[model samples]
Target: MSEGVTLDRTGGLITLGAADTLWADLMADSAVPTASAALTSFPAHARMGYVLLGDRVVATVKTGSSQWSVLEIEVRQAAAELNAVEMDRQDLVRIGPFRSAAKQEPMEGTALRWRQRITRALQERGGLERAAREDARPYHLAGIDWRRILVEQTRDRTVRTWWLPRAAVRVLDAAEHTETQWLHAARACQASAVVTEPSSHHQQVPALGSRPTTSPDCPTAPLRPYNGELQGHLYSVLSRKPGTSRRVAGWACAVCRTTPATVLDHCHEHGYVRAPVCQSCNTQERPDHLYSNDIRVADHYRRLFDTHAADWLRHWHRCPGCRARTTLPLPHLAAWTAHIACRSLRPTHRDARSSRARKPCGVLRVSWTGSHSAPRSCLLTVAVDFCPSGEHRVLAQVPYREAAEQFRSWLAETAPAVAAAAGPDRLDDLPTRPRPVIADTSSDGLALF
Candidate 1:
């Protein structure tokens, strides 16, 4: 009971160690607050969000940060230059020195060593799971972890406390995300494995569903009636015999080429059904995502506009007149050919101009005035506000398919086009110059889409 160590002392100020605080009552003074006011020690804090949680790894990265990456990767011998098991998540490529996207210079191999270190650390903490599971949150704090912040209180009675944060945590039933929007960023590591360099990639995991439980966009829409083709497809999927013939799960994601596409990512503007992108496409390739502008992406959108422009009218969720996502079902598809009124079976109270406008962007305007034949287009510019090297973006219309192999043709043709394209050219190619948000740039061509 006599074990005592004075942590602090003032006019009435006093602090106690954990032992002192526990047995202070046995001492002469029990009324004094025993909570350590001037705290010293701190716990380990994992730098990144991907921390282990009892056989699970919760993790998160900046959304849309992964333009392209491997789904899974493994290193064999921890040599100076080790070959990765899976490269680009498609082909197995050896780890050359990772290049700086801006300088295009080969970087150090220590990057892999760090990855090896962290992989081992994760195993020491716990481990990760690979198979996809349904019940997942954008962020997670697995369980009630036994950790606390040792706070240092200031001299004044006002109780100014300096907290030493050691780790990431979150509260339950709150808006708190544990820096971990998700916890599935770990691969099973070999007990003897070593990393000669640092590494990373987005492995295949459960995607953000059509109506994610939580996202920045609030007030999620409820499930509504879909078009006949989609409904029929769903019906076919539902009606299929268990463990037999081809299923919708066999569909591949057009974007990433992941098999068994889970959801359809359609453009809100045109409502044209684009393609069977891997279900992850719905979560990752969100609408309003500005493509860096490339020929392939432009061609993708153009084909959608050309093939299924009128498909929205077939769905029960369109305004029909304006072709927006509303409960009001428009009776007829907007007339593509000019000089014809929107021939709807029911009265929509819209006029001929609403009916005849070509390539409507779904946004209703007071009056429609533009070249009726051309499809809508926009320019997508990425990177920081200040760009020293040339900033290249393209306005996407159906016609620019021939525009410079890489839209360098259309980039010069028009400054303003619909949102499409990715990456910029390295005309200046000044590696020493300051530019922000550059993934990769080359005088040869861009690699984004």
Candidate 2:
């Protein structure tokens, strides 16, 4: 071994103690360099400066700011110059005639001594070196276990030892020319890692023959149809088998045509899928009662098959219900009626009951509008608003007969005085003046014409 710290010769590698913070700052800088313009040289006065020796990088930073500069240099040449002189252990580094002392304990190992020596050499070259002697307390180089030291191989075929950092640490080397390039590469890699897309294991759309018990748009809870036949029809229409022909590739709702068909609406009575419909049409058709009978479902299917016979034959070999091309029976219709009649018996068919149970009690508002200002416009709008809780919302609208009935029933049960103030005779024609009735009523009443 040489008089100084032995350098590993197998690969051009070296070891030195570094402050965890300085090494962290370098790696961080490697990840993200400030947007500030580069400076030509170290400023006249620096708040704090540190010397490290792995790749030979010297960092000078402003006291309270993130602004910093890292410098790399020839380790062999600097270490040689540092060994030329002999001094007491108190000496940290020598800058020409000026010398700085370790305030606590003198550095023992050759690596640390070389670092101190090189730091002073650079300061001397710049003519802004540390004063005659360091009066500050010596920083006990943090103990880094050799076993845990991270060895990183650079592209230049040179391996370097990175001191393990508990937190922000010191640096151990200098190589100024490559500092900017290294930082840029590190940052690019970090950015790429950050923006990489994450993979999810959950499937949104199911394969053919497999039914999804949940809708993608609303994922709060899963949807489980009451009957197996209903579930099968839902799966066939709502999902597609891989590689199947897509007649309605960009198909929109048949009823609204304005919105995408996300919900698979079916006849509640026959459990037969009618067609894809928007949420609005689904709500509207639920009250139609036109498809409430088995005969009606069969008639509707016959009409659909007759109109799109070519499309039906292209996808399926025969009618799904009867499994025969000649005559189609209403097997789904029977399943639908059976499911509806015994729905309350199933444990999973509790969504409707649960929803109704959660309905809150609040206020009511009614509004009526005549024709608008547009030419040849004949629009009469009637809407009813109800808020059982503080959240005011529109309960119903149009013809206003159903809304009026609901309002009257709620009024009679909760706040009868408000209903009496505005008599039933004027229900069609809301009173011009606002009625003052129950002051502490749970619901607020508003009537506008």
TM per prediction: 0.20, 0.15
Task: Superpose all Cα atoms of candidate 2 onto the true structure and report the RMSD in Å to 1 decimal.
Answer: 32.9
lDDT of 1 by residue, 1-449 (tens): 23443322211112223322322233222111111211111111122322222112222222234321111110001110111111122111111111322344332421112222322323343322221133132211222121122233333564222221211111111111211122111221323337886654533222322212222222222222222333212223333446321222334444444233434433332233444433223322231112212111212222223443223212222212122211111111111110011112112233456665433212110111222222222121112111223222111222212221333332223322211222233122322311121211121111111
The per-model lDDT (C-alpha) reads: 0.24, 0.27
In candidate 2, what are the lDDT values of residues 375-398, reduced to their tens digit? 012111211124323243433233
Q: Model 2 lDDT vs. the true structure? A: 0.27
